[model samples]
Each structure stands twice: as C-alpha cells, then as structure tokens.
Target: MILIINCGSSSLKYQLYTPDLAQVVASGMIAKIGEPEGYIDHFVGHRGEHHRCPVPNHRAAFALMMEYLQSPEYHVIECPRAITAIGHRAVHGGSVFFGSVLVDDAVMKALHECASYAPLHNPCNIIGIEEAQRMFPGTPNVVVFDTAFHQTIPARAHMYALPYELTQEHGIRRYGFHGTSCRYVSQRAADLLNRPIESLSMVVCHLGNGVTMDAVKGGQSIDTSIGFGTFGGVPMGTRAGDFDPAIIFHLVKDRGMSLEEVEEICYKKSGLLGLSGLSNDMREVSEAAAKGNARCQLAVDVFVYHIRKTIGAYAAAMGGLDALVFTAGIGENSAEIRAKVCEGLGFLGVEIDPRANEIARKGHPNISAISARAATLVVPTDEEKMIAIDTVQLTMAQPGAASVQMGHAPSTHGVAAS
Candidate 1:
C-alpha cells in the first residue's frame, strides 16, 4: 500500500492507497492537534465515516490513524506492514531539491536549513517525518516538495533584481509554493486540451486561503507570485501580500512599534479579512458585498482585480497563453469568483461559458469553456495524489519499473516491491 501524509501546522491528513491505487482504502484527518478538544476523523468504508476522538499531538494522531487503518472496523490492511511506503508533502525544499528524494539524515538536515523560508510549514513537516520514522521504522519514506515542480523556472525569472550578494547569501529568490497543485492542474489541463504538455504555455491560478499565480511556458515555470516567504505576493486570508517595505519602516520607526509587531500586522492583520473587517471566507464576503457592504465589496473587487491583473501580466510573459487553469478551493468551487476574474481578461482572448463554469463545480475535468484562442478549465487540486505518485516513483527501489508501476498502479497489478 502507498500511504500519503500531509502534515499541517495543526492538522494531519492521511490516506491509504492500495498497491493498485484503485480506491482510497482508508483515509482520515486529525484536526486541531495540540488542543484539548482536537479530534480524529476516521474514514474507512467506500464512502467512509467520521469518528471524533481526542488527538493531543501529531504523534498521538498518527498512532490513532495507524490503529484505525489496521482495525477490522476500517480494514484498510491486515497489518501495518501492508503499508510499504510513506509519502510526505513537504512544503519548502528551498533551492536544493529540484525533485523528490528519500528522507535520509541529509534530507532532514536540508529541510531544517530551509525552515527559515517557510516558518509555518517546514517545522511541522519535519516533525511529521521524524514521527513517521519512529512510528514505521524501516518503511520506505519520501519527501515530495511543494517547491520541486517550479524548480524548472529559469534564473532570469526566479531571481529577484536585488543586490547580487543578497541573492546569493540569503537564498532570496522566488521558489514558488503550491507547485504540486500547479503541476497536477496544468498536466490535467493539457490532457483535457488534448495537447502535449511540452507544446503548451499556460497560466495556472491557485486560489484558496492562500493564493498564487504562475506563468508556465512550455511546461516549465517562468514566474510565480509568492517570493522567498509565504507573506509576499497577492493578499490572502490574513497575509498582506506585496506591500512596500516603507510600510514596515513607518510602523517600526514612526509609530514606535517593534519589528516583530510590524511583521505580525503584515502577516496576520491584513488581506481580505482585514480589509473587509469581517470573515475571510470569500462566500461570506460576496454575500456581504451584495448586501451593500462597502468595505466587503472593496475586498472582493481587489481580490478579483489582483487575479485578473496577474493573469494579464503572465500572458505577456508567456508571449501567449494556450490555456487558463484554475485550481484550489475558491478557484475550483466559486463560479462567481471565476467569472469576475475573467471579466476584463478578454484582451487576452479568453472567454468562459457561464453555464459550464457553474456546472463544473466539483471533481476533476471541469472544462468550463473554450475560445478560438484559449481554453479555461477548473481542475480540482490533487496535491496529495501528486505527492504520492512522486514519492512512490522516487523512493521505489527498482528504477526501470517505477514509472510503469505508477502509471498503472491504480489498476489490478500491484506495485512489485523491489
């Protein structure tokens, strides 16, 4: 079995895929970890069920997941040994790892060095890796980085126009996040368009609580929004994106606030929630705007405007775009958001069928429309699946059979353990 594990700051999501990968034999999530009321949501049956049990820490939560997977009630596998490999979704690999690798002492050390780039993500990711190593000793494990997919970006694009010394010394470059999602969605879009991925130039919009726009030219990343840290780029749930450094200077020097306080404001007290003075939920913001909430209206407009403007910029960068791909929560689910984003994008020769956009609500293959020049698609993000596939391929002991095994793993033939 191939087990995929995504460890967030306060949650752990796990899924068990049989060697053939036809169905998710077992899947569950442990949310609110480290809190007293935190619980486990265990799912087993074809449709599965939600069971809530106190989960105090990641280790405890993982142990609980193991128990549930082995239990007759869940019956994911006869024993823990049935799980041959573990795939972990590690957020930042910095500039070191251009692809996935088996988690070794060296890899762990490199992850620690890159933790400064993703403060909220890397530490937790490392914790999960260490704990999983403890929980399933001798089990093959791999780390699939979110930044790996975008490593194809050329230096001219990924490098900022900062001092050369600063760039070289601090690793200050645009190592984009959400690369797994971008990779998955873009590949799916290529398949939907019935075009070879290498021949396509596309713009992928990944909008969730966190948002990013990437310009992919001929199957390689040319540019992306987020910079060295998650705090830059377009505004998100609580993050103040792409603000001037002068703002921080004013807050610290003029307002007599500490540097940390200023950072807290930028990272937590801005964005949609701050601008609207309400919830960060886009659906809620849309409703409020419709009800004549001025600030809320401003927030929605700014969000969509940012997306549209960025799309235009990416189109320019790519010289031309063959497809516009949307993924993640809001991009995949909200018809209104998608429509508003494409409103002024006609200059790029892109149009969406309103009816198709609305109906392509969930699941993959949500191709909303196609114009003479460009196609628009709403592909549900599958970062976990991408991570799992990468993990299985990179960590598989047998080299020649890896790709073939992965491509057909969802069928009856199981992965032949090397």
Candidate 2:
C-alpha cells in the first residue's frame, strides 16, 4: 500500500492505494485542525462512504486514519508493515527540487528552508512529514513538490522587472501553484488528444477555490497566470486577485485602516463571497444569478471574464495553444462557468459545444469539443495518484531498494509494484 499525504493549513487529506489491486483501499480527511471543533472523516474503498469524528492534531489525525484502515471494517491490510512507502505533497519546493526525491535529512532541511515562500503550507507539510517519520520509522518517504514541476519555466517568464540585486538576493519570482493538477491534467489531455505530450502545446486551467492558468509548451511550463505569491492571477474563494498595490497605501494612509485590516480585504474579504454578498460556492452563485440577482451576476461575470482573459494570454504566451484543459471543482463540474469562459475564444480557434460541456462531468475522457482549432477538455485532476506514482518510482530507484516492500501489487494502471 502507498500512502499519500496532502497537508493544508486547516486540513490533512490522505489516501492508501494498493497498487496490485488497483484501488484506493482507504481515504480520509481531517478538517479544522488546530481549531476547537476539528473532525476526521474516514472512508474505505473507492466510494469513500464513512464516518466523521473529532481529531485534534496532525499526529492524532494520522493515527485515526491508520486505525480505520487497519480496522476490520475497512481491512486495508494487517499492519503498517504492509505499507511500503509514503508520498507527501509539498507545496513550495522553491528552486531546489526539479523532481521528486526520496525524503532524507537533507531534503527535510531544504523543505524547512523553503517555508519562507509558502508560510501557510510548507510549515504544516513539514509537521506532517516529521510526524510520519517518527510514526513509520525507516519507511521510505518521497516528497512530490507542487512547484517542482514548474521549475522548467524560463527565466524571462518567471523573472520580474526588478533590480538585479533584489532579484538575486530575495529569490523573488513567479512560482506557480497547482502544478500537480496541471501536470496530471496535461498528460491526460495529451492522451485524449492521441498525441505525444512532448510534441504538444496546451493551456491548462486549474479552477477550484483557487485558480491559475498555465501555458505549457511541449510538455514544459513556459508561463503561468500566478506570480511570486499564490495570491495573484484570477480572483478566488477569498483572494482579491490582481489588485493594485497602490490600493494598500490608500487603505492604510487615507482610510486609516491598519495593515492587518487591509490584509483581510485582500486575502479574506474579496472574490465571489465578498462580491456576491452570498456564499463562496459557485453553485450558490449560479443559483442567485439565475434568480436575477444583479450582484451575483456581476461576480460570476467578472470571474468568467478573468478566466477567458487569462486563457487568451496563455494562448499568446505559448505562441498558439493546441488544447485548452479545464480541471478542478469549478472547471470540471460547472458547465455554466466552462461555457462562459470559452464564449469568445473563436478568434483563437477555440469553441465549446454546449452539449459536450454539459455532459463532461465525472470520470475521464470528457472531451468538450474536438472540431475547434484547439480542443477544449475537462479532465479531472488526480494529485494523490500522481504523488503515489512518483513515490513508488523514486523510492524503488534507490540503492538497496530491491528489498523494499512495495506491497507486491499492481497500480491503478496495472503497472507492477516497483
């Protein structure tokens, strides 16, 4: 069994995959960690139908996951011994790791050092790693970085127009997020298109509670919508997105709002929730807009406008795009949002068939349209599976890895245990 861990600020999601069986034996999530009313929701099998219970910390949450997976109800395996390796989804690898690596002392230290770039993510991620190390001693752990995949971005695309000293001293530049999703969906798109990924150019849209559009040319990121921080590009659940820096001074100096107060507006008091004066959920926004709520309509409009504009920008960035992919929550399920975003891309040779967009929800091989110059696809992102694949491949490549217990199972794709 391969365990994959994704640690967020207030949540920890995990999945146990039995490669030989080609199934997710167990999966769960702990929500509101560090909060008074934290809870764990664990499920066995592919359906993920299970229970929710109080879980306080990362260690406690992990223990809960382990207990349930090993319980007679789930019956994942006999013990931790059945689990060969652990895979971690690390958010910001900085410029250090261009690919996955077997976690060692040096790699752990590097992850800690890179926490400055991702204050909200890397710290918690490290905590999970440290706890897992203590709990599953000697087990091979692999760190699959979210930013590592985008390390191929060219200097001209990642660099800012700043002083040489500042750029070199601070390491300030564009390092896009949602790279795992982008990598997975792009590869899926390549498969759907029946072409070599290395020979294709595509623009991938990762729209969830957070949004980012990436320009992938010949299987490598050339440019992306996000910047130095994860808080740019299109507006998201709570992020302001593409706001003028000058507005900060105006709020602090003229309006007399404190820095913290101003920061809240940008990070928490904006986006669909703020604009619509309703829920942050796109489904709710769509419902309100359907009821002719003007503010909700405006919020949805602005969101789609930015998505379309970024799609155009990426198209131009990659010279021309061969395909446009939509993934994540909003992109995959919301036919309304998908259609609005692709409304005026005919000039770029992209068009979405209304019926196709509506039917392309759930599962793979959802092609919205193929006749357009650039095919528009809705491919679901599988970051956990990607992490597991990376972990298995990298850990088994090490020196003395021949003895590593890889569960002797086939992966979801029927690949044998490494």
Candidate 1 at 277: error in angstroms? 0.5
lDDT of 2 at 204: 92
- Candidate 1 C-alpha lDDT tens digits along 83-152: 8999999898876777777877777877898888888899999998998899888997888888877766
Candidate 1's displacement at residue 323, Å, is 0.4
Candidate 2 local lDDT, 1-418, one digit each (tens): 8999898878889988886527887888888877877777777744555455666778887787778778886668788888889999988877566777788777787788889988989999998899889878889898887886677777777776777555555667778888888888899899988999998889899998898888998888878877878778898887878888899999899999999998788878788988999978889998999999999999999899998998888887777878889999998888889888888898887887777777887454455555688888898889998898888887769585432321112210111101
Off by over 4 Å in 2: 46-52, 362-370, 400-418
User: Clashing pairs in model 1?
Assistant: 20-409
lDDT of 2: 0.81
Q: Estimate each model's TM-score.
A: 0.92, 0.92
C-alpha displacement of 83 in model 1, angstroms? Answer: 0.4
Poorest stretch of ten by lDDT in candidate 1: 409-418
